[model samples]
Target: MWFSVAIRVGLAVLVNQKRYQEWTHDKLKRFLENGIMPNLYYAIDFTLDEAVLDVILIQGVVQCPKTMELYTGPTYIPNNVREMTLPGSPSGRARPIMLITTVMRYHLPSDLDWFHQPLTHYDYRKQRATSLAVAHPS
Candidate 1:
């Protein structure tokens, strides 16, 4: 018998909006099931973050937590988007949180500490943080 633990990929979005953005879980579920990519926010050379979300969405299938196919572990996308209804609006947006728990070897991050930081009201501050590290684990 082949004994092995299974791994799976999970995607969860946590949004922080300037104003309350409206979107039901069903809507998001549908989009996710269909691999619909949101207008996520990220600066240049931040493909690591974007890639994690993209791969999970593109795969559009949950992988087991121990599945070898998934080298990257589960990714958790914490609330990041701000101010914008699902239908329209959005000067900017946040990255969709995803988990790749299938492959522990990869360790695809789900909840980076920065995810806890609130969005800045100031344009300059927000701009600077766009590419810089906002949180560090102690």
Candidate 2:
């Protein structure tokens, strides 16, 4: 049997006049209307033996331990989008948090019986992190 774990990509956006939720909503609307996926890139480039299958969006409430403030917003999955609505923060101090989780198909050797590995243990982590700023700092 093969097993794979979903990878979560966290987006921390500061709230402004234009909320991040609007961007997500518009992006999803465009995908629904035209059936075109936006150009996607990993924060770091990587090659994978496994494949991502789908995505699910979630709006969850995260309560602060001290203030008990709640933060909630829509999240995303890979190829598919499902959403759950949760109430916003009472203090209205919770920033909208969007998390993208990639559903994946794993290819594990049948003889191995069990497998244990960290996502960062992969070869991609060894690759140097590069950016356009670094290329032309001037």
Candidate 3:
């Protein structure tokens, strides 16, 4: 039973992905009239742990314009990022915005390092600037 349910859910995702890929601008017009179809990005409710899935879903993902394939994490977005089909997706902004939520992000280090050292405002700025310069040069 569980296997059947999994297969069905997987099939639904496959179908939805396909529909999104093949949808044309004219398809949306049917919604205005007496359309007999549903071709929108419906919220998915998969059989997964809510907490873990919540962590994953909170980050915006990119979809290929032609394929409608989903790619999670901005790590995949490169200089040659494929254009997205969905308007206002902001795949470009996903990197900087979602960066804070990434696994690499550090939060309140317990050990007191140079950053935690007592210093004047000028010293702090100088340190920060030096660090930034070293991290990314002009």
Weakest 10 consecutive residues of candidate 3 by summed lDDT: 31-40
Q: What's the CA error at residue 50 for candidate 2, in Å?
A: 30
Error of 1 at 16 (Å): 7.8
True lDDT of residue 111, candidate 3: 36
Ranking by TM-score: 1, 3, 2
Model 2: lowest-lDDT 10 consecutive positions? 1-10
Query: What ranges in model 1 sit over 4 Å off?
Result: 1-21, 36-53, 57-72, 76-138
The number of the candidate with the highest TM-score is 1
Q: In candidate 3, what are the lDDT values of residues 1-138, reduced to their tens digit? A: 222332333333323343334654345222112211111122121121111111112234545555567656323232223244332423223321111112232333323222354543321222224333345666
Candidates 1 and 3: which is better by TM-score? 1
Q: Model 1: per-residue lDDT, tens digit, 78-131? A: 223212122112234333323222212333233333344456543332543546
Candidate 3 global Cα RMSD = 19.5
The TM-score between candidate 2 and the true structure equals 0.18
Task: Write down the lDDT of every candidate, Cα atoms only.
Answer: 0.29, 0.28, 0.29
Residue 14 of candidate 2: its Cα lDDT? 17
Measured on C-alpha atoms, candidate 3 has an lDDT of: 0.29
